[model samples]
Target: MKKTTLATLSLAMLGATGAAHAQNSVTLYGIVDTGLTFIHNDGGNGNSYSMSSGNMSGNRFGLKGTEDLGGGLKTIFVLENGFNSTNGKLGQGSRMFGRQAYIGLTGDTWGTVTAGRQYDPLVDLVQPVQGDNWLGGIFSTPGDIDNADNSARVNNSIKYTSPVWAGFQFEGMYSLGGVAGATGSGQSYAGAASYSFGQMNLAAGYYHLSNGNTLAARLAGTTTWDSLFNTSVNAAYQSASSINNARIGGNYTFGPVTAGGYYSYAEYTADGRSLFTRAQKYNTGSVYAMWQVSAPLQAEAGYTYMHSTGNSSAKYNQFALAADYLLSKRTDVYAQVAYALASGTEDPAGGQAQAVIGSATGDSGSNKQALVTVGIRHKF
Candidate 1:
């Protein structure tokens, strides 16, 4: 943690020294999210109640700035850090700028390009229309198997995004593998696009990631997947050679109600180092409807179903409900409940049927689990 603090201080000092330009501006911003949560069947054996952090949204602080250069060009940067309000410890492996750290250039006619650690195209363009964006991970995919909870990040990445035209925009990203004599090892890449027409929105994207393994080609240690497979849901696929995901989503607004849904298909392909003999696959579907009952209050209901094939056969059914009240433009309070039922075979290395309502601790020992939480979020 001390190492992260020093890195943060150095970056802040450097930014402060360059804040004298008239056309440059830097702003500090953050979100503090905390809540009380109750779980029926945590780790599949016992019920628990605890104070939690970032159940609705991640707790984070960040510095972002833009400097206008001549000829309609600008320099932009963002340095964001994630933390846990409960323990005052760092998130995302205790990196100083774990959430994001990037510098880039934008132009009037050309597209934008950024380099550093960042979210992939699917998370950037396809997630906004998803239910998780409205009520957080409680409304997300099971085990976040499809990354609907935004748990993955790409390091050593370069991203490009085009300006919106006729309400259409597209993006692409690539993360390099910094191993010597191995250009393609441990690489990750993605592409996505979105279009808006009146009150309707649609998006699609694909992501591919190669596991970091030196025995295959060579050790390309640049790309780090954050160990998303370290959970009970998809643990057996940890030794897979590669992971691929394809997603599509759309949303429509009618009067005071908004409806949306998304579909995702993810495949885990094995290599010689894999645990399973064949490829493992997951198919997930989700939909939600949000109603604006009043000016300051809104409610939502959602449903999700997931199925597994190949290495193991499994099934999961989830239902969720939520309500949000706005205290101010930058503050909100929310309450949500999620219930899940699972049945099927295990992933060998994975645990019994488990759930990830608000935490990734472990799975429910039985075939069912429920989670309830209420929280407050403030942004500045």
Candidate 2:
């Protein structure tokens, strides 16, 4: 009888442990996107074609998990890696989890907090209302100078996100400078908010990053900012002391159609140590519409206008169109085309303002550039 009781108690304890373990969960997910691309007047090459990766979404794999802590609280973590599907090369400077790596805690009443390398608040709150959300970088700003395409990520960052209440949500983030002497050098911070009611959604945000006071840091780029300058649109301002960006966007959906637009203003400020004395500013605006032609077919069209002031008076006009056909729930094929025209004059350091379609294609080396891509994407 004693042995029987002991065995029964042991079984009960084992069952309790198993039940506890059931409350924790982990998931593996990823997206693979690859394509063939053609560029008109690519870097003076004249009609260039090549294999491209990440036409609509970056290739990535991620692990996410959560542990139930009870009382409506939980602990969560995510590790995401970005890569090039065409060459099997690691993306985001070859970091193992370059896309995102964060850990945090959340509760039903209090909200959530996380710390690590992650996207800014603007990307979290504002990007969803923009054209880039559907068509990717091809529909974004010319050089992505304002990070409208999420080309830049913050490191050593802590972020807080509030739970949705009454169709409203908000997020904020701050990155540590990690400079011993100067506390503010190389720092970044952002905040954003969104509201949705019925068929309409709106969002706005502001971001700021300090380039650090050292010339070497500016040349090599700051550790706090992953990729600040990717194209000629803002390459000349890499030596600036700081960058500031503000954006606002909204979208409305009716039946099978949705339309939205966004406006952004970015400025690179010069300090005493920089080459240019005045700030370089960019003003960009874009509008887009999407049609759900069918359950498996969708189409999108957009236009972008960018103007540069402060140090230069360059202008850019772009038109883009895209279509996607779904093969399955997790797979799709897509085609996109974009054309850009450049005008006005650029600073000597920046050379003549050449047309660059988003940040994906190379400069035209002339007044105009065009690009087309046919790609396939799979999610798992």
Candidate 3:
């Protein structure tokens, strides 16, 4: 009888442990944003309109969960995917979790360590108040020059974020290239720091990519007529061996108004000693101010300037204005307009023009491009 009772108790304990182990939860959340965009150019191309997504914020769905582990530690996981709102197609070239996918352990005092495909520190520390994240995407900082849009998500990465101390924190990330023979060949590294004081915030970050040869070659080989016309250069010239980006930015708020600015620099070198083996440097800067006109209405305006120097010396200047009306806490409507001019260079076919980088045509003829977009964004 004693032996039988002992066995029964063991079974009950096993059942209780199993139940406790399963006491965790997961949640699904997402945002969907879309709208119409219109572009006008001086070449009598008139105006073109199209559907777009993530104008205000990227459209995405994510699954996240956390499990409590008795003490002050917890296990967490997140899987997020970006998608197009128009056709419901996967974004980021069909990657399942193109936006983010990671698992980590957290402690109350130490910090968190995560491993997986994840964003670099640049975006985490610098993008929160930038135009791309706060105002709209139309005026993104030169293809998010500082990687503020998380443009440089690292694969096979390990990242650590430190606990905040006196309103200051630090972050670091390293990506394993996953190349068997050349372990460090394709790797990347990034670091950042930030601080907050009252209504003011500041951050600085740096990023470097080692073996971007493949990425550069791919970008160079893909050529289209539009690229030649708008950018004043062939696709080959747009490719770079590796990239180094650095940025510093901050914002200050007083009552119902806020103002901020940032400067970013990118250095691009050719992949090999080809005839186009010349290094190019791109410098960009922007500033803006925003005001809450009323309970539900707000207005923002900004300007940006870019300079490209090297084999081709070109200049680009842009101005933008936008307004937002909050319909509810989770939904808002907005409209934006921007004008850009390109000079000091000619189209690939030797015509002088001003055109947006992605929409350039061979017919230079002093080109000018303007854009207007109206959209609605909803978050959950």
Q: What are the per-residue Cα lDDT tens digits for candidate 1 across 245-333?
A: 99999999999999999999999888777767898899999999989989989999999888888878888888999998989888899
Sorting all predicted structures by TM-score, with the top scorer first, yields 2, 1, 3
Residue 134, candidate 1: C-alpha displacement in angstroms: 0.8
In candidate 1 the C-alpha lDDT for residue 264 amounts to 94
Better of 2 and 3 by lDDT: 2
Model 2: residue 282 alpha-carbon error in angstroms: 0.5
Candidate 1's TM-score: 0.91
Candidate 1 error regions (>4 Å)? 1-22, 215-222, 349-351, 358-362
C-alpha RMSD values across all candidates: 5.0, 6.4, 8.3
TM-score of each: 0.91, 0.94, 0.84
Q: Which candidate is the best by lDDT?
A: 2
Clashing pairs in 2: none
Cα misplacement distance, residue 306 of candidate 2 (Å): 0.4
Better of 1 and 3 by TM-score: 1
Model 3 pairs whose backbones collide: 229-360, 229-361, 229-362, 230-360, 230-361, 352-364, 352-365, 352-366, 353-367, 354-367
Which pairs of residues collide in candidate 1?
44-364, 44-365, 354-363, 354-364
Best by TM-score: 2
Q: Over the stretch 82-126, how does candidate 3's per-residue lDDT look in tens digits?
A: 999999999865888988899999889999999997878878887
Error of model 3, residue 167, in angstroms: 0.9
